[model samples]
Target: MAAKKKVAVAGLASVLLVAMVVAVAVTVTKKNGGADSGAAPVSTASKAVQAICSPTDYKATCEQSLSKANTTDPKELIEVAFNATIDSIVEGIKNSTLLKQAAADDSTKQALAICEEVLGTAVDDLKRSGGKLSEIDVSKVDGYVEDLRTWLSAVITYQETCIDAFENTTGDTGEKMKKLLKNARELSSNGLAMVTDITSIISSLPMGNVGSSRKLLAEDEGRILYHKDPSEYESGTEPKFLGKVSRQLLAHVKPNAVVAQDGSGHFKTINAAIATVPKKNNVPFLIYVKAGLYKEHVEIPKGANKIVLFGDGPFKTRITGNKNFAGGVKTFQSATVAVNADDFFARDIAIENTAGPEGHQAVALRVSGDRAVFFNVNIDGFQDTLYTHTYRQFYRDCTISGTIDFIFGDALSIFQNCRFVVRKPMEHQACMLTAQGRVDPRSTGAIIIQNGDISAEPAFLAARPPIDAYLGRPWKELSRTIIMQSNIGGFINPAGWSPWMGNFALDTLYYGEYQNRGPGSNLAHRVHWKGIRQITPQIAASWAPGRAFAGDYWIRATGIPYVA
Candidate 1:
């Protein structure tokens, strides 16, 4: 009887799969059924697939892998190829376990374990992307194409990171261990090529489809996105209301509750106050914190909706910890503050990881929630400083100082007028400013900096950061970052960006520069990668902070100065 029940469930799943396939087919058919005017002729599905695969180095493999997919849409073709690549990587993961057993030394075995973890994470990331892509509609939301660009770049990175484990494998720092990683690398490369082709197609889409002339996704006024009219937003008439955190908003926007660390206020600790807030509460919940140093890891868990955390001041109100990789903690775990609530807001607070440069991979703040805003906040650390793990985030007038992969994650983020300071690295180690990791093309995350300043302390760097510090490195294979309309000083390297090492070419990373001034803004010396592009003035403005992140829709509510 139990076997029969299991059979029934399997049959139900098969039927559901068929239904989904039919629905997709109908959607595609409807899209193609549109009227087409005479202009020579349009390419067929097979021709479209062939044309799409043309940009890939492994064209035959690309064509073969995408043959079963019926859609002619470039995005669809790329998605299909990515799914195939994911399947291939899963198979590669099985082989990785075998490779681990074959490791020649303890170092190699440890590296293989890391690689195995990366493989597992990569699989999960790829699966998550399928859902993320659906949320992007270029005609409605801005930054869709850019998000795709960054996410795919990250997907490529996951494979490359796994492959990177073999780097410096000596048997102690030689090059012989790479052969074991060839299969996974090849599969990722193919996926990367397909994603790169998708970027090209999107870039060539008359600029309009990518983001131009698009309407806001929703009408969010008076900080109430649901009241009166939760209708789809229209183009040209963007509502002036942005949720700003002013004295007025604070007085009127009463926190459903308030907390303080000094016992002088409502609560003694952050977690205690968070514990008081009911789960899945829909109302705007504000947590007004007092000035004090709270040495604790805090999380405003998921569904703790519309939380607003405002502190006395960035310097006076601080949250600090010293967890690091050297302390047997993962970088993600080292985060002094982990915010997992949606529609979260924070202002005038400092979140820091006290772990010094020697500790390595220490994270000060890890935010994996949607529609988050940080105003006048200080994020300080040495490595892996700020992890915008996932979701849509906006950082305004915040100071983030770190050394290696300082700001890295898989979230769609925009940094407006924020300061990124380079902290000192140990010995001969160099500082890398931003490591924007978006591992799936369909992911809705990309790092955008508008009118910010990149600065460093002379005393902070053991070696002067001038020619050594890079603006960023492709943490993910198709890592996407745009530092435009910002003042870049000499702290950044002439190359602008760095490769991920071990044959990780800059050709796949999509780093862009637009109207950036100062000594480090010299684009003539920037790395000439196949994916990088210097945008026109018209195109550059479209990617400005307010337009790209739709800041006017939500940021004004913070009362923070938003140039967009």
Candidate 2:
């Protein structure tokens, strides 16, 4: 009776297998450009054999598809390869008793090591591949689905093989193998389910050209906290709205004002301007600076908010000061324009510290504002062109040029369609784009660059102290940055990512990229660091402040205007 019941269960499993094969065959027939011929039904035994072979053949076909698909889109090919590799690894582990056994025997130990290595590599590959896939168009869904099916079938086969192996084992080895098989099967099944969920989500997404989905993806809910209809400025339309204020209501300098060549504006000197500004208030001081090149150092202390520093234009209005990091001060401390004031806005201005490339950390603009915005501003310096110290800031259509650590900051900021030009210095200096210092895990400490152009000119000499540069270094543990949907020029190092000044940064940074296109997007030989993660869109979206970090507070502050 017991034997009959076991046989009945096995027969039921065979029936399910047959049904799955027929479903796949029907699907393939529908996809092919051929008429389906009604054929006589095969015996159950033949149907079972075909079902067993179908998954294996499907994997081979998937590999071929990836090879061909790579010709048109290497990114898609990479995704297919990654999925296939991971599935194969999970299946292989499931089938091996050595992986399941806890014995110190040579075979078991070797198998265990191999299993660990494969799993680690799979996790890393998945992260990187997932990030790349987020940037692809929805049209790739069919290919992804087909690839997933192949992987799923492989996993199922592996589980069956492992069960059979366990049944044939003996003594302690058999018991250990059985336990291992159970765990392996559970893990593989969970992983397969996760892939299925991801595919389902992709399928449900509205299908259209890339342009149609751009708005849906870019509309970050957290942006609502900082959203505002731009002010109507002389430069056509703005992204945020500006309110009218009395010209006479001077928190520091009067509105529609001018500063002359001798540093004698309404407030006389830079110190005078800083001193006159009232302390600890949300009311902004409107300093309408005229078009002139003023050679002086400036600092806006803490408690100053809503300060509007306006100039004629970046070319016409310049604040030039000379300072270097080697001169006793730290890199972040040496700045020409250091603003600790919250809610700071600067437009149509150029802040440059002409201390030369010799200055290891001469900063142009050091901002530590809660809500800061720079528009049409040109920040010029050799090292640390723009130091976003803390809080949230946005740079819109600005030109930031520097040689080393050009854009180093610890702020949660976004650069929208901005220009990042790498200036080659007389000495060989390794130019790094960012060094994000995110102190707290809860803090939103990520630099997002959306649609930007990077250009560079050759330097005069080679191999200076800081000339051999990396694009960026992680200033602190858990520092994050994303260069999404952008073009990287050849001037960028072939290695792409840079290590910190010392080995300390290696263990703490979380650097990654998504949908970066152009000649420099290749990551075949990127640095192998555990901290650097290639994340998914879902993970990236969670990092958004309004969505995850400071949702309520941000929404209350910005009350962002809804723009169609």
Candidate 3:
């Protein structure tokens, strides 16, 4: 099996290389072609950690966080770091009470009020991740980082919220407050580094001997649950995979709740309709919200599993909220729409946080549900726009717009054929499009953006000529993200990926681009980082939502269009 997979990988790589040259030539030429980014080959050296903290981006933090750990393995280091992040976030939460009381005004009080719940949620999330971590046998799984990364991604999201509470605000949220979050931030960052190390170890493991007659198309589902085929659709042929069904075909999915702001439907508000849902139904409880701006905060709780939400269209239906960092709503709680149930679905709707550019950490949508799907939806905000907070998710034919860290969170998600709109930032501020939070070697989650459009607002791009918006920066040293076979715009910075802050672990983070087109698709000048790979078709296919992210099964269940 291993030998067959290896042969398949090589065959796919060859096909991808040739296809990349012919396919992306025009786009590359538009901005100075030839994409020999001089990216180093993926390291095939022994991945056994020489020292527990060696692979981590933040060395000091890694050392301190792993101090109590008994093993030097990369997997153990990741576990320790997650625990450390939990410890630090818990400490920060404890300190938050004092800060809230010492706050000068009601705004500060409000910010701190939300922080408590946000931090409390972090504790719960980390505890869950920690528990999940203990169950992963690094030796057996090819890429077991999904659950671990999902949990750590949640921690990273929480930590960002912890600090965002101080942004653009007047009060005691000064350097001292930031200092309170330093430990948690560092631990969270280390989790990203740990994940990269684990992948490296997995890569170093030798393939076992196997027969040559095996064909990948017929692998058992149980085997697929463990090992992903190294090639997708034979590599070079990047087929335009579509949804198995169309909207008209899916119209039979009935609704149990109807919401319209004018009271012309079953309910006047989205919240009101949610109140009528019976928890844990065997079948989906679809909620249809009519076209209108509904100004309310809504949460689809865990008990509301298998709930579905659909609207007229992303442009026609708008759900808006104004909870922002300065307004004292904790970043996590500031989401205009928060989905907490498993098997949740949203289609043709717009979710927006009205908090503008200065309201750092306002989230339009925060999804914590497992097997969630958002199709033809719009997630609009500035600074932390769409948060795939946890679990396995799929976003297809959707539009997500924001300024800083727009696409963030730790869902092992697939953003397929979506439009990532890069909004302009404050004067002279640089734009970093994504901040993926994967902090464990065992984590299966990474931001996979494929066959999509990455562009900036036309006016914004015109105003900021010689553009600066970038593909992304790692929220942690081990952050993982990919832009593949997509139509990229000129807004992207030539350097591609950016560092988290102040020359952090740019080398250890896993950032990649494969067969992307457009003026911004030129990978020649991308930041020369050790872990950054100009993905071959073989590599890209292996990480497909169907194979790696496990989106193939659940996404299909959503009755949405997807490549997998």
Candidate 4:
């Protein structure tokens, strides 16, 4: 009797699957002006497509991209959208290959080569997003949505990164590449919008998580917290809203490999120690560097997963390099330290680039990993410093110093109890601390600096009068950044945020401040741009680690003291 019941359930599921496939076929036939020969009404799939694409910015692109989907399931439809984006990007890569072969000089050819690489990365990101979407648990839609948003945002940034590589190259190669990618970019943006709209789409459907709603400001703007006195703390003492992991935890960490410049440990160079790390590690592979200065470009390469890199202290143990764009390396390759694997953790170390202000685009640290955490570390450089290159990242109790656009990237990152030290730039060049690259509205990538400090170096503070500084400028069209509950130094410009160009991204970007302190936090003379928002605490909380990056699930596993 029990076996018969199981067979009945299996047969029912098969029948439902056949019905869904027929519904999808009917919708596609109607869309293509073919005669509908199925009993399933076409409106079932057509209405679903309309509802999903309605929330997207490029409605036509979203609808047309999903027109050939083989299933009426919303999840399968999104997979179809991702597959369409991949097809478009593959075509873009082919065009880029042809253009690179016809380049007039080495510079143009190199730029085209960078384009091909980044575009390939973009395709990889979309493929990953599709795979994640396929494994989504309906009960945990919020967490899955955040992960999807981060990956899709990286896809948009990769496309823009390809275009930025052509800044110094000659000819219409850059323009030509842009034209080829126009459709792909639109499709990617539509993919993000569809993901953002997934909650509503699921709620409308008879789903398990229909009762669970995303905690966003639009739904609870009435719950606002009034500001307290910024003077509660002493003038020079920084406010502490979140706690840090104890130094005792560091003493307890046992190392699998040790690196020291004085030959007192397992390996003298950091790379040598990394080479010994076990491949395909399922657990943390601990590596400790004692105390000394090591000068070499270090990369925690892809597939070197779950590496724990610790040092004695930031000043006592340091890694430095001088690779810059002017030094004939690509900006993506100029990092003194690059973490390209997932679940990477670095503690109590310093990574810097000593190329000075003359180096056009030197990077101190470039992190292109998922779930990467940096604690009690110093990342210092002149320009294009700490590149939060991609993925979901967390930085706590870290100090990052740079001159212009020092902290930049498309990562969905949160900086808690961190410090942003603005250094002096070249003659007549103003300092802009952050250059966030969030190109799509639905991309969940944002720079959230809460319970932190933003001040200038002593020399930069006393620079010439015309050498001013601003919080940040938009590096992409839909860039998003928020400076909340932090101390902003008086050296910052009264306008707070700077513009990339004349009115560009001013009306499209998302810039906000909530309950910030210090002279630079004043909003009396702040920019009255459409993109800037006087956000509420509710909105600020929405960007917190627990909600924004789904930190509650993964952060604690790293033994990091996060306030999620």
TM-score of each: 0.65, 0.51, 0.66, 0.83
Cα RMSD, model 3: 13.7
Quick one: how many clashes does candidate 4 have?
0
Which model, 3 or 4, shows the larger lDDT? 4
Better of 2 and 3 by lDDT: 3
lDDT of 2 by residue, 1-564 (tens): 535533443344344455655765565555563354554544433333333323332333343324333222223333554565555555555544344455555434443443443344344435444563434334444434433432332343333323332232234554554464454344344334434534444556555563333333334422332333334233332212132221212112235334555555675454555566788755545576667777788887766666677777799888988776556444545688988666677777899988887777688888755567777789998877888765567776789888877886656677767888777765444677877765333334577776667666555223344244455777666677877667777556777778765677677778877767777666776677877788688765654433322212322232222111
Per-model RMSD to reference: 10.6, 19.5, 13.7, 9.2
In candidate 2, stretches whose alpha carbon ends up further than 4 angstroms from where it belongs are 1-257, 262-271, 426-428, 458-469, 501-503, 542-564
Candidate 3 lDDT over 301-374, as tens digits, reads 75687777878887888999988876666676788899877778788889998888888778889987777888
Worst 10 residues of 1 by lDDT: 233-242
lDDT of 1 by residue, 88-124 (tens): 7777677667767877776567666756665665665
TM-score result, candidate 3: 0.66
Better of 2 and 4 by TM-score: 4
Error of 1 at 379 (Å): 0.4
Which of the two candidates, 1 or 2, achieves a greater lDDT against the reference? 1
Query: What lDDT does each candidate get?
Result: 0.68, 0.56, 0.70, 0.79
